[model samples]
Target: MCVSVCVSHGICRSLSLCVYIYSNTHSGGGLRWQMAEFTHLVVVKFKEEVVVEDIIKGLEELVSQVDIVKSFVWGKDIESMEMLRQGFTHAFMMTFGSKDDFTAFQTHPNHMQFSATFSAAIEKIVLLDFPVVAFKTPQ
Candidate 1:
């Protein structure tokens, strides 16, 4: 059996939230995700007087240099609804192919340096990770 995976713009197009991947043909052509992915979700509230722009830029640059980072996104809170008071003003979502990849990204020198600075400037944060068991998207 052989598989043809889709890679778009260096991103595994098949590896987004709730999306499915197909590979390894049986008697009929089909696809499957060879491995599950890990998601690292982080929310942070900057301390007073901290330069939020610099922090975001540093984090973006740090993750870009880590080869294990399959996908990464960061942004400020949208503040759409009235009950959206989580206090964490920024969010980051990063996906990795495996725990090893996640660890590699975490331990990368650039990440280490960023963490050192981020830890000091953030007043509060919430970090959570979980394996993506299933993902779905609407048309």
Candidate 2:
């Protein structure tokens, strides 16, 4: 059996945490659980002539305009092995309460409008979405 519970975000619509539990029969029938959050990862190499700050500002605006966007964090690659950088200079990670919320964000009018402008400013881009299975640190 599997179970999921939304523990927080009753008052704050922008942030939430959900716990999922799975029974493991092989491990003496014990239960295992994980914190599940849907994550949208964007890695980009912006056009040399485009103003990157404007793009960042637009992303910040997205979090504010998009209600389903639980949290937004982004950064430039500071120190990584040159060969491993893969021509990607920056990364943006957006967390959502669930994949359904992300789908809503994708179809939102504001996102569609921003996407067109954002896509034009990028020389290269990679977008990935996945369920974040995070484990708590044992204390």
Q: How far off is residue 137 in model 2, in Å? A: 6.1
Q: How many clashes does each candidate structure show, in the order listed?
A: 6, 0
Query: What TM-score does candidate 2 get on C-alpha atoms?
Result: 0.79
RMSD of each: 6.6, 4.2
**What are the clashing pairs of model 1?**
18-135, 18-136, 22-31, 22-32, 23-31, 23-32
Highest-TM-score candidate: 2
The CA-based lDDT of model 2 is what?
0.81
Per-prediction TM-score to the true structure, in the order listed: 0.71, 0.79
Backbone clashes in candidate 1 total 6
The per-model lDDT (C-alpha) reads 0.72, 0.81
